[model samples]
Target: MTIRVVVADDQELVRSGFGMILEAQPDIEVVAEAGDGEAAVAAVREHAPDVALLDIRMPVLDGLAAARRICAGSRCKVVMLTTFDLDEYVYEALYAGASGFLLKDVRRDDLVHAVRVVAAGDALLAPAVTRRLVADLVRRRRAEAATEATPDRLAVLTAREVETLRMLARGLSNAEIATTLFVSEHTVKTHVSNVLGKLGLRDRVQAVICAYETGLVTPGAP
Candidate 1:
């Protein structure tokens, strides 16, 4: 099946660049292009593409807002774009339900692969960019703890789950976790899915944030 895509960016050049890269893939097709967030939302509603490639900064509406609406309204996967490796909006985008987060200058292969990942209903966030997302979540979690009551989800995780999650949040893929725990990859996937379901998280990205929020994994710590 062809993976229909919508490219949204403030700059025509960037949008064209991304659309060009994606169109080259035999399994990919560009269904629409939007120059702003509002337009992006409209395009999704109009095209109902399989994946939406959105830029973080746009006039009238930003990618985060657009992603929120798009994800809520449709089953289409959202992939947020950033110029910098560490974007302040990256954390917000994850919480907004983006299926993937990618840098603006991503390689052709990476961009193409990211689209396929999202289309497959699997999420992806560049490991380098995950640092900022985790850091931001940790900070917000501390603030929330000071204000609201403790989240019950934090207690829902079992000890074994906590261990699996910490490794996952640290950017270890399923294969790596399976090796570390001496378990099969299928077992690791099951544990990860259970963690997300119990916590009501959308995907592994939120699971990553949860790991940091609960202090299960410290950023940059061995």
Candidate 2:
């Protein structure tokens, strides 16, 4: 299936650059482009694209607001763009339901791959970068007391499912989680599906956040 996308950025050059890169892919199509958050939201409403690539900083609406509006009103997955992986807004975007985060300096192949990864209903985040982000959030909030093995919100999941979610928050792929648990990849996938379903999460990104919020996975813990 062709994955339709909308590229939103305040810079004309950035918009064009992403557009050019994505349009070059056979299975991906850049159906619309926006120069600001409002336009981005409008384009998503009009085009109903499968994915929306938004810059973290934009005029009129800003990417976070645009992401919130788009996610609330449309089914399009959001991939936030940033110049730095450590941008403070990265965690906010994840909380706002973004499926992925990408550095503006992303290489050609990584950019293409990010779009595909999120389009396939998976969340994308650089593991090392995301670890820092999560740790930072934990530090600022002094929520160390929040780390509980079984939070009320996660009461619906079985013990095995909770373990799967912890590994996910640690940035383990399904295969990695399978190997760690000495289970088949298919079993890990099943656990992941059940975890998401029980938590009512949209994707792995949200699941990671939920794990942190519920204290299933504590920051700075080995």
Candidate 3:
């Protein structure tokens, strides 16, 4: 199936450059392009694309707000774009229901792959980037006493499902989780799906956040 996408950015060159790269792919199509957040939301509404690549900072609406609107109003998956790996807004974007994020200078192959992954209903939870960003956000929240552990929220999960969520929060892939549990990757995927379904999460990104918020996983812990 073709993965229709909307590339949104304030920079005309960057927007067109990404569109060109994605348009080059056979399975990926740049259905629309937006120069700002409002247009991005509008494009998603109109195109009903599989994915929406939105810049974190844009004129008017901003990516976080746009992401929330798109996520709440449509089935399009959102992947935030930022110039910095440690952009503070990334955490909020994820909470706003973004599938994940990519740096502005992402390589062509990775960019294409990210669109495909998110379009396939997976999160762009790269171990190095996602872990660090989430850890930092958790730390800040902890310091401010803003995070209250709600262990009861995970009551619907089985013990094994909870373990799967912890491994996911640690940035382990399905295969990695399978290896640790001596189970097949298919089993890992099942557990992940059940976890998400039981917890009412959008994707693995939200599962990871839920694990942290529920105290199933702790920042800087193995």
Candidate 4:
């Protein structure tokens, strides 16, 4: 199916450039454009696109706030990310429910790929921007344990389930986790599902964020 899209940015050139790239893709169609945050929300509700590529800084409403509003109201996947991979707005955008992010300087192929990835219901990290927040390993572990202290859904996780979750937070892909733990890929997939369900998260994006915010995974760590 064609992935319907909306490009929202205050800059005319940025919007136009994005439109051009999306328009060239057979699987992606630029359904609308919004020059500001409020208009972006309006356009998204009207067009009901499969994905909304939102810029963080826009007039009328900032992309971060707009993403929160849009994601709250729409079923569409929201990839509220940026052109500059290091743009700090990205962190807030993720907290606001962006499914994927990319730098504006990202190659055309990578840009298009990000859209497709999010549209498929996956969340993405800013490419190569793993965090460097410096709580020591012990402190980090303590923080993670604390963040999960009152998780409403932990009751649902088995001992094995929790083990799978920690490894996932460590950034191991399903295949890798499976190999490391000597399990099948299908088994890992089942554990991932239970983790999401028990944690009350929307997808892997939120899970990744939880992994970070709860101090389970530090981006820059090995």
- Per-model TM-score, in order, reads 0.88, 0.90, 0.94, 0.81
Better of 2 and 4 by TM-score: 2
- What is the clash count for each candidate, in the order shown? 0, 0, 0, 2
Greater TM-score among 1 and 4 belongs to 1
| Candidate with the larger lDDT of 3 and 4 | 3
RMSD of each: 2.2, 2.6, 1.7, 3.9
Lowest summed lDDT window (length 10), candidate 1: 125-134
Q: What residue pairs clash in candidate 4, if any at all?
A: 83-103, 83-104
**lDDT tens digits by residue: candidate 4, 1-222:** 999999998989988998999999889999999999999999999999999988888998999899999888988888765667556666566666777566667788888888887887665643435332111323444555774554434456788877776676665778888998899999988988888888887767667666655545555556
Q: Which regions of candidate 3 deviate over 4 angstroms?
A: 144-151
Please list the residue runs of candidate 1 whose C-alpha ends up more than 4 Å from where it truly belongs after superposition. none
Segments in model 2 whose C-alpha atoms lie over 4 Å from true places: 139-151
**lDDT of candidates 1 onward, in order:** 0.84, 0.88, 0.90, 0.75
Query: What's the true lDDT of residue 187 in model 3?
Result: 99
| Overall local distance difference test of candidate 3 | 0.90
Cα lDDT of model 2 by residue, 130-213, tens digit:
666766665565455545454388889999999999999888888899999999999998999999898899889888877777
* Ordering by lDDT: 3, 2, 1, 4
At residue 197, candidate 4 shows an lDDT of 84
Query: Any idea what lDDT model 2 has?
Result: 0.88
Which one is best on lDDT?
3
Q: Write the per-residue lDDT of candidate 3 for residues 17-127, one digit (tens) a residue.
A: 999999999999999999999999999989999999999999999999999999999989999999998888998998889999999989999999999999988898874
lDDT (C-alpha) at residue 32 in model 2 = 98
The sequence of per-residue lDDT tens digits that candidate 1 reaches over residues 1-222 is: 999999999999999989998898899999999999999999999999999999999999999999999988998889899987677787778878887688887888888988997797567845566666666667876887776665556688787788888887777888888999999989988888889889888777778777777777776665
What local lDDT score does residue 57 receive in model 2, on the 0 to 100 scale? Answer: 98
Q: What is the lDDT for 34 in model 4?
A: 92
